[model samples]
Target chain A: MQQNEENDNPPLFKSWKGMYWLVLGALIFQIILYYAITRYFE
Target chain B: MSYIDWFVLLGTVVFITVYGIWKTRGTQNIEGYLKGNNSEKWWTICLSIMATQASAITFLSTPGQAYEDGMRFLQFYFGLPIAMVIICVTFIPIYYKLKVYTAYEFLESRFDLKTRSLAAFLFLVQRGLAAGITIYAPAIILSTILGWNINLTNICVGALVIAYTVSGGTKAVSATQKQQMAVMMGGMIIAGIVVVHMLPAQVSFGDAVQVAGEMGKLNLVNFDFSWTDRYNVWSGVTAGLFLFMSYFGTDQSQVARYLSGKSISEIRTGLLFNGLLKIPMQFIILFIGVMVFVFYQFVQPPLYFNKVETDKLANTEQAAQFRELEVKHQQNFQAKSEQVQVMVNALQAGNDTNVETARQSLNSIQEEGKSIRKEVKDLLKKANPNTEARDTDYVFISFVMQYMPVGLIGLLMAVIICAAMSSTSSELNALASTSLIDIYRRSVKKEASEKHYLNMSRLLTFAWGVLAIFFATLASRMENLIQAVNILGSIFYGTILGIFVVAFYFKYVKSNAVFWAAVLAELIVIATYVQTDIGFLWLNPIGCLLVIFFGFMFQVLFGRKLEPVEIGIEKPLKSGK
Candidate 1:
């Protein structure tokens, strides 16, 4: 029953590093988008 | 409230509670009770983590914060994803490998019994007080807005949560949160749509955002760095990372959420899920508040959002002065409301010049409105020194009670109530687990039957519930309920995080060094909090760094006399058995 990458093999990514980057990348994207909104609105 | 409203509120809450109880009915033995028998899926863990973090104060005070302070508060969560990444990378595997029941359990293995106990005690002190606030914040607000008894409201909320949390423990808390999160998101979405719909017929959703921006309500990010400023991009990323790392990394309320996951991937996936969605969640909530700001551009909001204080003020001799200010606020609103339309029409026509001219007019009136509000607050204090005059926290709830349609009111109430219950259950569960795993079993009772320990866990959970109720009773005035929680967390979280940081990375710094380091670091954090104007977020990093620094310093002085320690070492769980 314990089939899901016990050694930290992520479902989609080759490694957990990919998942971490994806999240950090999303954070960066959000900040850039939010900054754009701030610039555009203000 | 109407009959239908009351029915909807009670029915929704009751069904969720019953479903949680029925679903997690047979939680027998200490392992199932504390760790949900390690059977939780990733999605359930995700929502449970968010639910535990949200609390009643989040639902009650966040929108109000946005209404008064704009979306700059979104920056407060900027460090969350980063923290999630760190926890996954460094904290999760060690925890799973160790098979620990609480975060502090890892501390004992890495350092010693004293260090672990010290961390547990800090968590208990902070999470205990937080449990009380989670119950009290919404109940107090609900009672104030609806003319109900505050103490009765607190007891009822506490009792409702205890009813389910005591029966099933961690499993019940997690199982019920899925339903609670659904209600929370669904109701908030409806409220957002309704706010936009309630805007003037001529004003489009796009137009409202434009208006909010022109009025300085869309302040989503501030790049400026200041030690004193609470929320901005710099603080959010740096100081916010430390705060969140401490929270999700060290605090058992959150740690317990992920620790229940069946596998390392489940915990990591669920936590990353939180990172992915949390900002958007906060953004949506804050955006709704901004839309309410836009809605009020067309509709006249109360001069003071707290109706009770205003009504009480009217009965006093200063009624004439208050009445004069109300008239001034109304006239000011009247001018701004019309000017808003002119600006909106100017935007439609693509006339930047006309928009700028009208924006100037709106800004001037808004400034006048601020001074008028300040005068009213000053006069309120002059009328009765005992009255709390911070009305911003009441803005969103008052708007909801005054304007949101009947059934929606009930659903929204369920959202706040569910938030309160969901978080309080987590705190109570975590408090009980920490008490049982760290204190009662480790120190007081050396050996016991599994059945006895199971019963003790249930009893400790119940005891914590009663203590939370007691703490709620003694709770007094604070600035904003949501920020109040964060401020309290910041004071203690840094030192806790620092101790964990030292244990994880600096093996040379053994138990005695880090324990005293944490102690010194905590004292300095409290002193800094008491003695400085530094923003609360900075305290997280300051306290954390102070611990690492002191840990190294103390280790240098004390390392020659102690046994060696190593990382990634597992400790057996002996107490819960």
Candidate 2:
């Protein structure tokens, strides 16, 4: 049976862990931008 | 609809359909037909998944949602990126190891055939109906807005989808969607820019955004928590997380997308890209709606966006009352337009006091306009009880027809139809593969050749296409079935996801416990839905967690020695091995 985990390496990140953090961090950054937009416009 | 618009719309749609069929022609092998020969790149998988999720209502209703409500709805997607990462980590490796066709195939390997069949049956029931809705929802909207026959529109869209999907299956669905996603995002971005340009010359883009903010349409982040409130941050993260997890992980339409990826890493990249892009896509659509609201503030908008009902009201006995309300609406627009200018001017000068005072006055007048609009809807309903009074769905399409240029109008129409076809094709392709691999070969015809299975796959795809069109035709007569279908999806998705969660996570829970637990959990969810006012979205988590909790209990009581389940595949998928 095939298991591709050993073959996987994401670009710009040494580990998939770093890649996932980037996604999560982007979410945080997005929420902060949205909150700022809401506050500034209000 | 000018000649150029018609040409562009027809030209773009026909081109995509033909391209899909041409690209995937002569797909005689089962692997090639069902999984695109495992040749898809990350970009194709990304676009296919995104296109499958974004139906026509997403394009039509999202902007309108922003127009009526605020961008508070963006919170609902806060959970999507997180769900993507989780799926990439937990779900992808298992499916790749199993070399499964449908997500349901993984269930059989981990548990029992009954468990796998149960999940597949639930998917067919919900997604089968949803496929029709994918076509019907937009067809009805476009038909009403463009004065075309709803049935004809349904058949055209359905037939166009069936032509390519039946011919080429998964490869066709993925190939066509690249173009579909391009048209969808391109049309929306262009529409957003155009709406900003359409605003009064004196009002800058920043000024218009502030007016929307003042008018309460830019409520992007609502940190407040409430159980009953739909779009708050609290509910979006929790309930919304379960919903997306079930959708992206278990649902075959989405699973089929990444399942076609050439490598597991490519699939992971595709999903991660989708996670990153999905929220921004929704924001653009909603921002366009807000900008349309700002544009309408300067220029007079219809008292009601749906003119069919309003026109019908004009010939009724309530015509005089309708005319009076029309005049009142005119007066309301005149006052509101002038007040908007005042607010814009105050905002520009940075005079906070004048801005606040103008905002208050503007909101009061906006309230008056809202009441007037409600009165007109009530009048329309009174005139004809069968009239569809809510016009929010019509809001964006009406703007497109009225404001967008000739060639661009055709492109926008292409965008709507492309969204419908993209999702519908995925549904058909997934349904066909599920029906073939999960049900027929496994049970009905265990020893069939690949040629026979390939033929069956194409035949099943065509059958599902016809069924979807039949349901789309049937959908026109049913009132509020869209909401019913959504509730239907939420109702079953939790239990289905629960079964898979057990298959993956609950190492101790055997088939007997997990299977029966799923049944009981579904029963409780249905009973609660019928007996209580609890929102439908909550059913997903309740159903999921209940399965886990009950599986543990049942495992302690009735659990017995496991039947050694078969991992049926004899070879590796080699999926980037």
Candidate 2 residues B1-577, lDDT tens each?
A: 9999999999999999999999999987888899988888889998999999999999999988999998988999999999999999989988887777889877776777888789998999899999999999999888888889998999899999999999998999999999999999999899888889888789999898889999999889988887678897777878899999999999999999999888888899999988898899899989999999988998788889988878887788999998999899999999988888888889889999998888898889989999998899899889878777899899999999998887889999999999999999999999998898888887788886788989999899999999999999999998788989999999998998888777777777877898999999999999989998887888999999999999888988776753333333422332211
- Which segments of candidate 2 are over 4 A away from where they belong? A1-6, B561-577
For model 2, what is the C-alpha lDDT against the true structure? 0.88
For each candidate, report what fraction of the true interface contacts it reproduces: 0.52, 0.58
> Candidate 1: global Cα-lDDT?
0.88
TM-score of chain A of 2: 0.79
For all the candidates, what are their Cα RMSDs to the real structure? 1.9, 2.8
lDDT of 2 by residue, A1-42 (tens): 222446687867998888899888898899889988888767
Q: Candidate 2: deviation at residue B141, Å?
A: 1.0
Worst 10 residues of 2 chain A by lDDT: A1-10
Where is model 1 more than 4 Å wrong at Cα?
A1-7, B476-486, B561-564, B568-577
Q: What CAPRI class is candidate 1?
A: medium
